[model samples]
Target: MKLDKELVRDVLLAVEAHDEPDRWLAIKIPGKSDIEVSYHIMLLAEAGMLKADDVGSHDGFEWVPTRLTYKGHEFLETVRDPEIWRRTKEGAEKAGIAGLGMLVELGKAYGKQLLKERLGIDLP
Candidate 1:
């Protein structure tokens, strides 16, 4: 299945929200159900937004660690500007409210509840 921009954005959001950076710093995204997240990471990698490196093996399975490339960090900085989000939403006619809602939901269990709370966003 092809990965979409929404999922990719979610992945980046999730990563940046990690307080235990060590947890994700050298770990491949977990759960087989999240293949699309991995696929999105691959696309980001190709776009030079992410870099994948082999960390080690797990039960005979090769584990790859993904980290934000410089470009990814830059993108994150840009998106943090509410103006960019506002303009993007306006130009694309996308549901920014719904998108932010979904992101908050993902952040709930992904170690970002404090940040979400500080931002006055509720997560599912």
Candidate 2:
């Protein structure tokens, strides 16, 4: 299965929204399959954005994402705004950008651009 950016955002949002830090990130998005959610959580784990434990066998996935990392919070902050997310996606699509790495970078760039526009400050 291919990576879904929207689902990725949703997963991160859900994980961040969890109030109890002691509890694991348990996501259950309606209209999404369990395996799909598992897959996204697993991907987040692999991406070094989340601290998770893989407890599944070789057959399927069963992850327990504990919390987000510093990088995860940074990325989430960049793409958290709906307008920024839409522009980021639009810019990336126009540039034929793919992969999580590039996508995140584009989002960051868009976020910086927004800051520059709003505050006349540029981030290095």
Candidate 3:
């Protein structure tokens, strides 16, 4: 399954919305199959963004994301705002920046620029 950054961001947002850590949450994005969602969840877990447990057989397993890590929260904060996410993705694509970490860094930079512009506060 191909990884979709938008879907991954949406999944993180969904997970963040729910505060319960012990409960199992099912991510249901329209037009996305269970396997695809599970694959993204696995990727997020591998990236250390979330904690997930694999359940079921090796051939057909389900990924149950338990909770978001501190890194996940930071990443989400970078991309949570719609304008920041759009600008960050566009800038990253233009600069050929790959990898989630790099994108998040770019987003943080853009966020700082936006803050500086809005509040006239110098951010280093």
Candidate 4:
């Protein structure tokens, strides 16, 4: 399965939105298949974005998301802004940069731009 940026964002948001810190989250996105969501959840855990438990069974793979790691929070913060996320995706597509590393870099660049424009706090 291809990397779905939108789904990645949604999963991150869902993890972040879970209010109960101590309980495991059941992240279900409407219209998204269980496997697809499950795959991305695994990817996030592998990428150090989320702290989760790998509960792979005979049926298939699954995870119980606990919370976001520091890296996860950093990336989420960068892409949480709609405009920044939009610009990051657009720029990535235009430049043919599909890797998550590039996406995060692009997002950070746009996030810095947003801070400069909105709060006049320039970042080097």
Candidate 5:
């Protein structure tokens, strides 16, 4: 399955809101199947954004995220706002940069721009 950063962000938000541990539940993301969500969860775990347990039964393994890590929380904070996320994604796409790290940096820059605009104070 292809990596969807939006989905990743959504999942992180959900996990952050839940604030629980060891509870594996299905999260609903529009246009994404359960398997796809599971795949994204696995990716998040691999990215060190979440801690998950591989619970496989006779059928298959299910990835269950226990909680968000420090990095995950940081990333979520960077992309939580809808406008910031949209701008960050657009800037990254325009620049042809498609890495997670780069996207985070772009989001940070966009967030700072938004803050500067909101406060009308030039940020050095």
Candidate 6:
């Protein structure tokens, strides 16, 4: 599946912050729209990279916690490939999104395995 780089990034951000129970980790990622974030979740599910656990719910919305499948982790590694890295860097350069620097920092914070868990695209 050709997951958008932006969406993949958001998924990784959210899964890494899985420890936080109050809100979504993707929300912390800079400048992402609501649709983009939600789409990442859907894509992850559709790709079978992310598994939804019935963590129950509050109010009308179900509170499902997503866990990374082994395949998902593998996929994330692909995201870190040199090719993808170059694309990411070029895109960031073109957009002048200094926030991408923060993503760089996040990549370091979460480690390589976390990336696979969140994005479902593996890195080289």
Q: Can you rank all candidates by lDDT, best first?
A: 4, 3, 2, 5, 6, 1
TM-score of each: 0.49, 0.88, 0.89, 0.90, 0.83, 0.45
Which has the higher TM-score value, candidate number 4 or candidate number 6? 4
RMSD of 6: 10.7
The residue-by-residue lDDT of candidate 1 on 1-124, one tens digit each, is 6445455665676666655544444334455344455556556666666665433346432323246767766666655545444444443444443333343333333324444656866656
Judged by lDDT, which candidate is best?
A: 4
Q: What lDDT is reached at residue 95 by model 3? A: 83
The digit string of per-residue lDDT tens for model 3 on 84-124 reads 89988888779877577777788899889888888988788
Off by over 4 Å in 4: none
Error of 2 at 6 (Å): 0.8
Whole-structure CA lDDT of model 1: 0.51
What is the lDDT for 29 in model 1? 45
What are the lDDT figures for the candidates, one per model?
0.51, 0.84, 0.84, 0.88, 0.82, 0.53
Model 1 clash pairs are none
Worst 10 residues of 2 by lDDT: 17-26
Instruction: Pick the winner on TM-score between candidates 3 and 5.
Output: 3
Across 34-110, the per-residue lDDT of candidate 6 in tens digits comes to 44555556656666666654333463322243566676665566455655555555655575553433335434434
Candidate 5, 19-105: lDDT as tens digits: 466676557778988778888888889878889877757897578787888998898898888999999989977998877778778
Residue pairs clashing in model 5 are none
Q: What order do you get sorting by TM-score, best first? A: 4, 3, 2, 5, 1, 6
Question: Which structure among the candidates has the greatest TM-score?
Answer: 4
lDDT for predicted candidate 2 compared with the true structure: 0.84
Off by over 4 Å in 3: none
Estimate the TM-score for candidate 6. 0.45
**Model 4 over residues 1-124: C-alpha lDDT tens digits?**
9788888899999999988867788889988887788888888888889888878799777887888889989999999899999999999889988777788899999999999999999999
